[model samples]
Target chain A: MNFKLWVKPFENLAKKDRFTISILWVAMVLAYWLITTAGEKKFFPTPLQVWQGFAALYSEGLVVHIGSSLWLCLQATVISIVVSLVIAYSYPIPLLRPLSRAMSQLRYLPLTGITFYLTILVTNARTMQVWVLVIFMSLYFITSLLAVIKDIPQEEIDHARSLKCNRWEILWEVIVKGRFDYVIDVLRQNLAITWMMLVTVESILVAAGGLGVLIKNSDKFMNHGRIFALQIVILLVGLSIDYTLNTTRKSLFRYSKFN
Target chain B: MNIQYEEKDIILQVENLSISYGEKVIIRDVNFIERNVVRKEINQGQVVAVLGRSGRGKSTLFRALTGLVKPSSGKVLIPDYSQAPSNGMQPAKEVEEGDVGFVDQKYTLFRHKTIYDSLTFALRKSGEKGSEKKEKVMKYLIEWGLEKVKDQYPNELSGGQRQRVAIIEQLLSSGHYMVLDEPFSGLDIGNIQNARQSFKLIENGHDLNTIIFSTHDIELATELADSIYVMGYPRLDDGSLGTVGTIVRHFDLKALGIAWRTEFTQDHLELVKEIKSAMLAS
Candidate 1:
């Protein structure tokens, strides 16, 4: 009876998400054109010149810098995961809950300046950078896990006990199950924050060979094309990781909303 | 199903049991027993419901039995069986290990786990391994009408369905005496009926299965239990709950003092109209 009903499918194409997706597609196309159209040595270099620069870097045995940056991030992320897991599990013990919670809230304290100062005092650049990155990322990771644990309802705890489950069984089964989605959600959100922290860590003069260093060096030389290229590389990497993690989260909880 | 076995003479024997939470005593020297609790001499299944006004030590009795709350004074001796202490000073006695299943007043499904995971977690932890355990879990799930939601999260389930899941978890762990505390609380009529039917199937066997629960719903308790323990507020003397008097009652409709009341089909009420009438007649 309603013409709107017949046109609903087409009408949905104009909705916010679809429109946003379309806008993104157009923006990417325009960005590609703008960068390519800009002559070499201008405000933005051609995509080919940027690719050649990347190729040249790889050929010149500068790949070690990329590997170093990646290895550092990997170490930091793995350390953060282990440290946070231990903090989260330890929270159930009578004395640990409050202590862990207090430590986690301390994460809200500015990590950037803390990392900067700590790096200066430590005297060694590489070890200092790794430790600072790990410490800063671990705080947020552990806090997020604790928040998930606290969010679990008492009803769920009672249910596990009634089944004649011991303390560990109850924690593993009921408490963990009830709060895992939120825990995963927290992890996904923190991945971005971790990278930002890592960038800050890289920006320090103590450490060498990271994307942050490249960007900083380009800015100092007033090499706009190199700056743009580095920015693009960082954007692409961050976007890819964010997309993958988000998709994994959704797939893991397709039947229900985790958060 | 008739539970075919040699009934161990005294299934449960509680002698001078007392329970205190923090500084406050909840249950005190409550000497009670079901003489010939499980008797092959008489193969009859029994369900007991403990009903009382809000603060009358119903949950405390269950906790005391399982040793969750330690008894302040008296010793609880469950005949000739003792295992090492687990989670408390009292050893998980033979009677305590798999003998009692407690359905807490609060829903206790694991937050991050699905119904299937909750069930399997208990079995695996309790030294149940291999395909047989999985089969047993699957069997219980289907029997309990939870096959459809076996993979669903606890938060997604309705209160009654979650309760069923809890029951399934309990049963899968080979719990003999299912002690439910206010399981029917916060449920609608339809949910209550469904819960009743589910419970009915589980408690049908003669020897192995017995259900004991504390409930405020006097009518449902009366309908389900073979015997009922009803308590009133014990008078307080000098800041302590004194043992004054208990309005001891029993429910068997064929016997006098037990009759269904309320004219409305939809509305069920617990009134002592007939008991009072019988008293007046006497």
Candidate 2:
């Protein structure tokens, strides 16, 4: 073993060594939990107990709940992406700049306060849940996208003007088409925010039986083991989504890596 | 052999131009006129170089020339091709954005577009259609030796290929006028040679084609530009250097009997020295 290689800062590890260290690190975490929780504790559940709880939930229609949450999340995310892109891309126009600016700043407003108004306006439970998630994600998405648009170099716009592009064409070509990859990146960032809000939105409308409803039920009955297992599942799904978006960005915008 | 050339009617005119941001003046009192230069036995066009030190508002002057920035005081004029010439003189109008094409030092092509697609996009305003537009862009791609890299993105191209694409993009879009800001600032010998060839490709296309560029290399400026303008801070009444940039010297090489020559002679070196002294003084 090259001991110095492991000790040095910012040093690269061999792939085999990296894999070995990762596995060992996970094992160490598991061993620490087992060692520390010798006696039965109220809040802390053993790893095996959590696994059994997960298996029980899996048998009792957990897959349906996961699918329901995923479907709702997808709907809200799609709406957010489209709406945010429209506002952000139109930000350069003098007439639309103020509107876009106000929309981007909406992230600071309390989601619960907006939810009160949305419940009054939107009568249907499912529609209200979707709107809640959409509002939450769209605000953050607009903020991220506006930053990306703002960072675009002025020379690109000047180059477009030199090519005889009118104001609308400049907005389309330079501001919209030129920054599509950055849009995808911003989507990736804001998708995480959407996922974080998914449970809260789903729990508010329990008529829609979803992962959030399952979590709320487990919490109400003091089923700590089941709650931990469902939390683990939620974390894994979020990670998988993040991975997929990262791969999509890498594959679609191969040139973005150059920047 | 005396290379016979006639200076005809004005092609571009910048009259008493000044640009500023609030209280700070960048370039002031910048005035120059470029006329069509027709040479016998060969096709030639104007390659005017604006030589200046860093931060002397060469970029501001270029922004005005390209109509990207409105001048604070004066106007830039070019022939209004939308109207016909009256009594052997083309109708002149104030320049607007998109009148002159500009390529910066980075050779900034759209990062997402391939060379072929970028050229196609440049022709968006052109009234050509379908296969005709594609053919026109393809002809340029082939002639400039960029056909092989047509499908490749800008990052996939080398420095020379990107430069050609940038120049041709502007050539096809703006037509007749192209401005390059520090085209040769960070180039090596081979790449610089490629840039020189790119200039020829542009000049060979049209007699009215003009390439106005800025560079710090005195020797390269003398080698490329038939006319040179030195921009720097001028002496004030109190003998202090002024902050506002203005053209302090103009070298009309056409009158010096040195332009269009196959070689840079001792006279060119002497001229470079004179330009250097002028730059240092201002």
DockQ (Cα-based) per candidate?
Answer: 0.26, 0.72
Name the best candidate (by DockQ): 2
lDDT of 2 by residue, B1-282 (tens): 556889998999999999998999999999999999998766788999999788889999999999999999998999998998899899999999888999988888888888999999888888899799999999999998999999998888888788889999999899999999999867788889989999988876778999999998888888888899999999999999999999999999888877777788898999999999999988
Show model 1 residue runs off by greater than 4 Å. A1-71, A94-124, A154-183, A205-207, A214-240, A253-256, B1-18, B24-31, B35-43, B53-57, B74-99, B105-107, B111-121, B124-131, B148-158, B236-282
Candidate 2 lDDT, A42-114, residue by residue in tens: 3478877798889989998999999999999999988988898889887888899999999988889998899
Backbone clashes for every candidate come to: 13, 0
Interface RMSD score of each model:
3.6, 1.1
lDDT of each: 0.65, 0.89
Model 2 chain B poorest 10 in a row by lDDT: B255-264
TM-score of chain A of each: 0.73, 0.93
| Structure candidate 2, residue pairs in collision | none
Question: Evaluated against the true chain A, what TM-score does chain A of model 1 have?
Answer: 0.73
Candidate 2 Cα deviation (angstroms), residue B13: 1.2
Which digits, one per residue and each the tens of the lDDT, describe model 1 over residues B1-282? 222333234445566776676777677666655422343464445567777665667777776665455677765444333455444433324244334666776556665578888788768656666687788889878887899988988778999898888777777674556778898899999999998887677656455466778776666765666556665444464555454223234444313233222122222233334323322221
